[model samples]
Target chain A: MSCGSSPFGALADDTRRAVLSLLSEHGELTVTQIAEQFTHIGRTAVSMQLRVLRDAGLVKERRAGKYRYYSLRVEPVHEVISFLNSLYGASLDGLARAAEASADQEPAAASDAPDPTGTDKDTPRWGISY
Target chain B: MGNLVLSQQRHLALPPADVFALLGSDRTAGWLFGADYQALRVGALVQFELPLNPDDPNGSTVDAFGRIASLTPPHRLVIDQQSPWVGRLICTLTPVSGGRGTVVRLGVEVPEDAVTWLLRQRGYDPLEEPTPPATVRIGVLTSKSGPASVFAAATENLARMAAAEVNADGGVAGTGHKVHVVLRDDASKPEVGAVQFRRMVAVEGCRAVVTNVTSEVFDAVAPLARRLGALLIYTPVNEGGRFRPGVMRLGERPRGQLRLALPTLVREAGGKRCYLVGNDYVWPRTTNRVARAEIERIGGVVVGEQYRALGTTRFDDLIEDIAAAGADLIVSTFVGSDEARFERQSYAAGLRDTTRTLSLAFDESTREFTGDDAARGVWTTFNYFQELGSDGNTAFLRRYRATFGATAPPLSSITESVYEAIHMLAASGALNTDANLTELVSAVRAQRFSPTWPSAQPEQRRTGEKALYLAESIPGGFRISAN
Candidate 1:
């Protein structure tokens, strides 16, 4: 898991992901309150993880007096989701175009549609399937 | 000195008219210079004799004279002097708010070439020769990023300020060269520090380099500096160690700091049993030995001791152990963010309620990182503090604030020492004369120049008799308490 360059790299850790999840559920929490939720790890460790999350833009902090409040930033997560959707959506569009072209060129290309029932192949497949 | 400029200001409780009357009267003129002068008016020559020593009858006197350049009643007065040194003097008076008082400001501007002549006239040796080269280059190595970055803030700013001041006074003393500072960040890594050191010497042609970095990085850079035959002035408080010949250590020795602080800790703070904690390095380890020896000498026991790797953030177990040790004080030698982390965690663990902390390396910059409450009541010893009350320090602080504004990084001993070292180097004729590394080192060691801030005593060897002030952490910073 990377913690230097990419924001997603910060969420790759179980503890950091857990921290983001907690912040997402709770809206905002101080370092002490967040540390209290985890008994196994020390506060310093949590603070360090929070620092990494903060550096990666996964969490934003607000200071009230001496206390610092950390909250989950959804913009980074939304950007990641949009990025992944674009990647898969492009490939799915290409596949749909290829299937349509094959049907238009080869009217009897019944295997391309993969009929589940043999009776569908006996009729005009396009009209029957529709 | 011909190039010397003296600017002084005072806020008087009297009104502007009264202040102006006093300044213009012959009585005040006699007090300023021991003779009556012509009435204050434009184009009038004012002459007076200044006795070298007023108490001694056999002492010599110098004829000081000036021409009144401009006169604006109850507002501004300008005088141009050419006798002892070629300079210009200006005085201003402005009314204070509510018609209550007046603000008086006096300024003196002299050329740099006449500074040596003026010093000679005053029976003092000039810091440098009368002529200086066209330009000179100095190198600075500091951490701009990494774990040590917290302590490295304002290192470059202070060095630049020193260089700018020197250049403004007409370059280096004899060479007449403008001082140029080449700054490079070590990234708080040993190898990177070595590389930067080599680049500064071999590439930048710097004869001397000042380092404000960790002992680890300093140790790595020291050998390279020696091999290159360049002068290294180390400016961080470190564990006392054996160094090369041309290298000068300006930081306080751990033995000296703890020697002065431990006895007071045991007596005033009632700290008998102490817990030792620090980063596992030469500085902390060596300093801890000094602390332990001092504690034992003072009839105190070392209840517990622990070391963490550099950059270690987890301090829960250590705090728990310290609390369980039943010690009255925690002697920590941690540096930078590690110190802040340890202090904050210790406070959270409730150890601070019963225990007092005496850190070897805690400074103003470090206190900013550790929240006010987390670091409250913690004690540290240093030669300089930002809030020190002295005329020289007051002027220095005023100039620094005016230059960098209020949001500048807090002034710590490390950065201040860098400023001192640069000025000391210039005073030693390193930049003014064509001396090699060994000769320059010898010259620097021989001269006893007064630092800008008041040290315990004048500097003799590479180390000086520093009056360490023990301070307790307050809300914004450390407050020097009664020793």
Candidate 2:
């Protein structure tokens, strides 16, 4: 299968992502050559990993001397860069959510203190100071 | 470059195998903990609360966590540790190797905030006059307040006693180095502990810190020690399984404890049906994981195990479940206040009527807190106690009673191990003058340290050459069992 515009997240697994590192570290290694870095696994496993990286546009491949050589095409990291930007936004949004949660819990706590009148302080804020 | 990403960034030339190898390096793990000593390194994620508290034991107690931002190379690591306490935090690691060994000093500069600059107060001189290169400084970053305050009291005394003994005799191998200890309070919080540790190294000129508080606190300090190029002496929950190079763990590693205790427990129970309980967290989580594995390995069955939330005050529901398990033994790891609560409640639930309990954490202080009546019939195991051994123990007990008052520091297992950590470190530090962290580390690794061991080999069989001994609760204190 080929990587679509929205398939960026699918390429995040170790096998797919590590392909670039393997190629870059060794410089233009064949599927077999790249597989040497991950020798604990089988050669076909390495080829499948390389396929994912090629689909992600994170690796460039060519047939040389009857063997397939894969090189790093790091241009796709720009998409990863955007994904990381989104991650930062999500993290900040999480912080904001946490802030709102604490803010909401505060009045519930304060209202239980008992108002000056005979009413319970936390009697559902129908009116607001703001 | 390889995956040797222990520093922030890679040189882009190292291979993954080399990087992975470095990851497993003790030297690498040492720098991973703290970056306090040198000017700083690139991608050096040292946790520094710049604006620190001078009087408080732990420096600006910031709950710090972060990822390595950028590894610049050669002598600098820029760690991106952002926390509530730090608006901007950068730890710079620079090697200041005066001679053969590198003096990695971590310089933490706060360019953005003044709320966090708790360096040594100007003109205060947090450290003493510089001694020669051969001297060794060990600080006790203890807690006088907070949850761990009780344990810290004995640990501080223990460390001091060990230093006193080392200095009184000929200091380590005629290195002629005097052992000095500085006490700082962690308030039982890791943030506080990390900060205090930073200040102790940066200001007080300490090279090592010894503690056995918690995995949370230990984790916090461990990373910081790497940043500072100092060593942390740990008496971890499972003795010292986490014993890396710069990090040295002394007693009863959880694996070692189980290796010894589980088999004995199975033999004593006459079968493998076991009930386990812990104050649900790191210590118990690890203990149960190892326990379950051991039980399966030994062809035993774990009937019931309950891990309660930390700070849980009651264990009635858990005990009820434990009682229903029909198990022969109850294994536990409840520490501090929860320990007492668990014991008293377990006794109240009448679980003891059917089950024989074996504890991994109860000791003299725990019994004192829970009342011996409630703690009675509970069998506890540990590495050391004042009651365990001979002339050394008698002298230690006499001095401890005299120092803390007869009723205080009743020689609990945790405190005794911590006390022994100090004695061992001081003894090794004095003998070692290679003056490198690794040398002192090797010395500690080579030393057999059970300050309270009686007749057994320096290492007990149960905790694997640990002073780990078992005793059943009596009316007064624990009695070291012959079994």
- In terms of lDDT, the poorest run of 10 residues in model 2 chain B is B1-10
DockQ of each: 0.01, 0.03
**True lDDT of residue B92, candidate 2:** 35
Which residue runs of candidate 1 sit more than 4 Å off their true CA positions? A1-130, B1-133, B432-435, B448-464
lDDT leader: 1
Looking at model 1, residue A86 earns an lDDT score of: 31
- Candidate 1, residues B1-483: lDDT per residue as tens digits? 124344545444444565555543433222232233355766454543433333322344333445577889778877665343345667677675444344556565655533433322211211222223456677888865445766554676688888888778766655667777876666566866886687677655777888879998998988887788788899878776785887888787888888777876766557699999998878888988988898898889999999998767789989988888898988999888789879989988888778888998898877866767889968888877777776667777877878865445678887788887777676666653245888877766654333332231223322545667788899877888743
Candidate 1 per-residue lDDT over residues A1-130, each given as its tens digit: 1123321111144467567657766889999999998988989999999997787566889999999999976455334333322322222222223323333444444233332121111110000010
Estimate the overall C-alpha local distance difference test score of candidate 1. 0.65
What DockQ would candidate 2 receive versus the native complex?
0.03
Task: For candidate 1, report its TM-score.
Answer: 0.57
Question: Across residues A9-116, which tens digit of lDDT does each residue of candidate 2 receive?
Answer: 112444543555455456688877667667478789988877766775667888877887778764543342343223222222222233233334455422332221
What is candidate 2's lDDT per residue for B382-473, written digit by digit as tens?
Answer: 76765765555677777666664432345566776666666666655433423577676676666553232222223343344445677778
